[model samples]
Target chain A: MLVSTARLHSVLKTAVDGIIVIDDSGTVLVFNDACVHLFGYERDEVIGKNVSILMSEDDAKSHDAHIKRYLDTGEKRIIGQGREVSGCHKDGSPIPIELSVGEADTSEGHQFIGIIRDLRARKAFEQRVRDLQSNLVVMTRVNALDEMGAAIAHEINQPLTAVMLYLQTAARRMKTLEEQDPQLLSIMTRAVDEADRASKIIQRMRSFVEKQEPQKVGVNLASLIDECVELVMLGHKNDNINVISNFSDHDYNLTVDAIQVQQILVNLIRNACEAIKDCKKQEVYVDVDIAATDVFIKVTDTGPGLCEEVREQLFKAFTGTKRRGLGVGLAISRSIAQNHGGDLFVEPYVKGKGATFVLRLPLGLDGADGQSNLASASMI
Target chain B: MIHVIEDDFSVRDALQHLFTELGASSCTYSDAESFLNFLKQVTAKDCVLVDLHLPGISGVEVIKYLRELSDPPHIVAITGKSLAEINKAFTGIKRPPIVRKPLKEECLLREMDLGTALNSA
Candidate 1:
């Protein structure tokens, strides 16, 4: 069925996408309503204007050359092909658009009609999908790391624990033997210590993986803090960082998961060490206070304070400020604290001074909900 | 006499030593295959301390195969994994007593002595 020219013209004018027809010289001959709306131009404003005006600055400069080359060679590079290109909006901002051009042999001469689809909404939607996919990948990878760490901890801990036990048993036997060699006993003692150290490392990994239920019990807060400090400060003494511990002699026995609390301390201490890595006079001060209803453990470091970006997402998982940090350390630490019927927070950071992390634990089980039993750990 | 099937060399030697110190004759195998091969000549009244983690056939499989014999040796499961994790392998079968490792001397000695005494009785 052949349609009349008037009817075809009205149909083209009401099309959803922008349509513009240009002559051989690149002069705009026919501009539809969609084209006018898309380019923010009136129909009369662009009828006789150069089509290059609708292109971006760089595209506008090369568009005429491209047409001249096509005319000279009679070759169609983009004439029959659809492509993604940038268009110049009337506001001078570049807009992503998909364009397909078709050439026709008209009675007047050669003419090119371009169908332009605005891709701002589509591109934004595509980008949003990509972001969500990447987030899922990151989350899955983190979860895989947690499972792997837990497996490794169990495997390594077994042998290390065995070695420690065997060494201790051997040392006991040697002591009972008549005329035991002191040198041999000393070597055996060192071996036992090394095994103990390896077991401790595996325990750290297990605690960080947080794959088990928190065994909450009444533990001495001061002793737990000391043990954590000892664990973190091991092999770090040569860095010239003075670790000062001030404990209130008051009885601070609290029902908490000792292992989880130790993990939080290790994370805090490690973070403080990283923070003060570039400082000249480095010091990490741990202060313990026993209140009427709660016990507070403050870890303060002497270094460059928190930046705006780090401060905003300090407690958020996967947002570490360190170069090689997993970023989940603080998040897990804070979670463990909260699970113990308490909270963890960064004391307002002071510039040029340092940062202080406060861990508060409740003295009683009144406010201690079952939320603490939930897993409060992550792996790198 | 007892048989020890453990993959870790240190822990394997330690178990052998502990058994020897307790005045019991024992043999050690690094994997389940060797222990299974040794089982052909093995007799009753002996105990097998098979670690739950092994290179081939697994400790659970070894236990299941032993239980098929007319007079199977008393099998004790040694593991670093939690008891609940290992218990899944013992469904519809006789579950052996599990001894957790970093094996304390008293716990292992008690388990081995109990198994030997039960077998003799």
Candidate 2:
């Protein structure tokens, strides 16, 4: 049976959504007005070329693989499901669209009719809503954390200051009375050292909570790891957790935001403390290894590691072990790592053991070196 | 003498220690209403470390009430509230000072404005 030309033309042109028909050879056979406006493609320009002309390089590569399976096996994965695809416009911008393709076998040859829905507006609206929600959450958390930090700092500093003063006075008195008793002098010296350590820890936490812009420097990851461990330990003075570091002597230097490194370390360290809670002997181990290409920061804790159920949605926001946190710490850390072309992950090394989170980064990703690579990759 | 108006007990105790160490007199109040009731029978203090977010009247309102006095204490609005709140509440003063919370001992002394206080004395 043969369909009338009028009926086929009506199906192609009078459809509510955009529809386009192409021959087996990939020449555009028909174009509707919606397709004309949705994309800046005209009938004259598109009627003679390959479909790859309207797709991004990445999209085109996948499309080639997609067609190869269908042409050889006559099997289809997306013909009925309606796949989301990218369509390149006349101005070289890729327009996001959902495509439903139906193959029509006529007496003449094989023709594919494509129905496309433009998704740009819908996606933009969805993205706007997400951004608003994210911004609101960040703003609220930032304010609360800021205020809480301020209170903790102000209130904690007073006694600390008093302690500092008394220690200073005692130190001077002990010096003057050294001939009277050396034991008292030794005791005063010990007191002074303890007070100083306490003060330093408080200062570090106070600074961390306030979150000044990090000291940007070219730092050796191996050395920085040692410093960060000591700082993290200071915050957990009362806890039984012992943080041990295993490192490679190789220079693992990178120009990065140091405060960010400290922030992540603190977060992981805190989590490690929580993980090892109630264990006989709590331990948090850190391994920093620098290979020829990458540097690694692995934080391992003793608490019953990541649960199998939680593993599926592990890195998702709002899923945290702590009741008080927003769970953005790990999420933010992951984003920071990925944005710098690094990777962050919770690695399940052995079953029924402590948890280990690994952060891997390139040796160098800054300034002239990074910019040139990004530019060349973009061009290609 | 100094009055410390703070809600947190630990913070209030901490401030008391700070004032004692500073060689100043101190009276503590958990909220504004209690502080005001005590102030009616007593005279103005030498300084007050007032928290902005109080249970009853705000820290800024307390400052306003002090401003209405014949002799307002050297009002130093020390707040652990947000920078925005402290900035808005404890601003545009020629005498005395505003100290941001997590108060450094040095900031407290600096804000005491000893030079101005001595001239007035």
Candidate 3:
């Protein structure tokens, strides 16, 4: 019996999943090595504590009643089967776990042995898959809109071409006539001007829809951000806004379309500058942070932060709070970011603080296939 | 002489009228096959405005055939397609000056003059 207990202890200590044994009074009897690691506590710290200490607040409140009910009714709820549950770490953060509980009648009384497997990594992987699937759907819809825009531009441009030519031809003929009417000439000129304006609108629409394949090349992240900041500051030379750049210690090298990425940076920096133009704080913060799979470029301003209503419409085409231009800048910027397997979003607004916009780009070249298809569709 | 090859009737007529007003003698064709069939050879003194999209034979093929002649005409590409499309179609070849539609009068006149000057030279 002594040899058997030592071997059992060794097995519990070496198991990959956490194992814990609790007595009838809910006191932890055995806390294995894996259990110590999973709970962020040492075996000595948890061995004799109430098992309820490892449970979430609500779970702890009902755990004792559950044990008593099961003991009295001889009923089993989770005693024989595995199910997902939340465990409270020593630091008080909830940890997702798959737990299976079993009971054994011993000389000391009934004891429960619980085995737990951490589900954090698997849950994160599942969430990432769901996000990618949704991104693919958005990209498909954007591509269809690009194709329809191209067709519309082509069909309408032909008629506009003919109309402009006819109007200019009429005006030229009038100039050649012996008796030219000044009012007719003026009216013809105005008509020609309107046609020109219409043509320009079409050109703008075409440009918005035009999909040029991203010429991705390796570039230093610091230098790119510096260049973009300089470009933006040049336009605001007279403004008193303070621009601060914070780059992480590690030098990041990213493969991206430099010009497109630069466009997004310039727009973001310029928007931040404009936001704080009238504010007393007059500051813009540009920060670059690196993660394992992606890099984030955050632009924070000192202006009035975005409200709920404006934030909702911030990324939609033709909707913006600014009085000067159509709000397609953010919309186009977001699409460009998405095409490169990245994302652009406004951070949650805080009252009395400036808004923050984050541009996230994947470090790897994984979205090349979707981008190429978009390029072809837009070109057509 | 200026030759206009366009599948669209209204555009072709307007271009013809515009070239006439500019005092340049011009001829028009609706497709590449007709133009190639009619014009056995083109000289350095001539200029051609060819739409990149044509009905029977593609404008790219016509441009290629024209380029092979001993003295090819000065060719200008006109298209409603985006610049990216044009660049892709003309990859690996020396691209000609492109005029996008709806055509700007000044842009057309300038390209026409440049073509005529280059051809005559």
Candidate 4:
């Protein structure tokens, strides 16, 4: 029985954990293999040394008092139930550990045994995950703020210029005429110039926020729709939900903001997926048809049609029906379409069917202005 | 005569001084309620320069209130918030004029049909 007991003790010593035993006088008695691995000290080096030697500065200060009290008063504090404690490694890294200690009373007096579970790796991983999540959220909010800054730049730029021209005209008139003809010909002109700068900044911001690789070269509506659907599926689609796309052959291209267009498609697809979450079919259908004058891409979800309330402010910013999101997706999408001399609309799907979002852009990509589509093709 | 409705202190402060300097007779209100109260009593041949976004009430409602006036002056929706809001303001009132800000003196002069200051309101 004594030999078997010795064999079992040796087996326990090699197990993956820090196991330690101390005599009633607090002299070291047992130190296991795992303890050596954790502290980077051999048994011969640590077995006779004081336990406090293995603790961090803060841990050692309190541990000194704890052991002194137990020895003096025969009172137990943390020597029974396991408590989370910090351990200091040889390399000076702090390791989190759960320690359980108990006393073995014999004719001589009592000894204490401790079991410590290391949690350094797990805590490190959790911290890394939290840091990444925090960074992602911060970036997304900044992107939204930046996007609005751009939108305002476009709208305010023109009137600002006209205002400036009026200023210069008034300045000349003021010198030539008697009365103050809005002393702002120069001021208005400056405001317009500044507004133009603001618009450029806005465009730059949009480009910065969505810096994903541009799908340049003549991209057809069919291919764009497919790409969008694929992206949505990666995030939201699953075994229960499927998406079907029907695209028409389009031979033309638009001098379009392809990144902006993809953004719209993603929003629409996401909106559709969210809409049909609990429906039976749980499928979203995207149908693309290219006309001689326009290109139409419609997204239909099997979910119930939009309620009366959602229909009212369908394309308004901040005021949207989505439960999760900036509610600016559709609003931004609509604006991009409008900017491209195109339009995105919400048409009644089938009377009792789902919602249909249609995107229609003018034929020939360069129609938004006299600007060449060649510029767009390069960016694409 | 014009009713200046705005909320952003910095922008509104500049507008108050700008309109006063430009020689347009005006009253300034920081909130929709204060402006509505003043507009109710100030019955005259005056235009309204209102921000589209305001605290307590929307600029759209302000437009509706002006439309109900017995002799409504031209309501010019002035804002620096968003183009969508400007578009909505125009569409809401069937093409009402709008001026967006930094409050340029010439834009204000031209939009308000202000002739030479010698013919002050």
Tens-place lDDT digits, model 4, residues A289-320:
66767778788888888766677688776776
Instruction: Please give, for residues B1-121, the per-residue lDDT of candidate 2 as tens digits.
Output: 6777877776677666655544466789999888887665434535666777786698777877777778766777765443433444556744337665445555677777444433433
Candidate 2 segments exceeding 4 Å error: A1-11, A14-16, A22-28, A37-41, A44-81, A85-97, A103-112, A119-155, A158-380, B1-27, B44-53, B70-85, B92-121
Show the colliding residue pairs in model 1: none
lDDT of the structure predicted as candidate 2? 0.66
> Which lDDT tens digits does candidate 1 get at residues A1-380?
25688887987878999998998889999889888788898989889999999999999988888888888998888888999999998889888999999989989898898999989999985675455445434644564466456555665656665676677778878887899799999999898777767766665775566555456765666666665666667648688877777874334456687666777776788789877888997899999766777778899999887767777788766566567756767766765565555789888767677888999977764644222433322110
- The local lDDT score (0 to 100) that residue A125 gets in candidate 3 is 57
Candidate 3 lDDT at A189 equals 97
Question: Best to worst by lDDT, what's the order?
Answer: 3, 1, 4, 2
Clash count of each predicted structure: 0, 4, 0, 15
Q: List the residue pairs that clash in candidate 2.
A: A153-B102, A154-B102, A154-B103, A275-A303
- Score every model by TM-score: 0.46, 0.45, 0.58, 0.41
> How high is the TM-score of chain A in each model?
0.49, 0.39, 0.51, 0.49
What is candidate 3's lDDT per residue for B76-114, written digit by digit as tens? 889997766677578798888889999977888777654
Question: Model 1, residue A266: what's the lDDT?
Answer: 69
Q: How does the DockQ of candidate 1 come out?
A: 0.13
Which window of 10 residues has the lowest lDDT sum in candidate 4 chain A?
A371-380
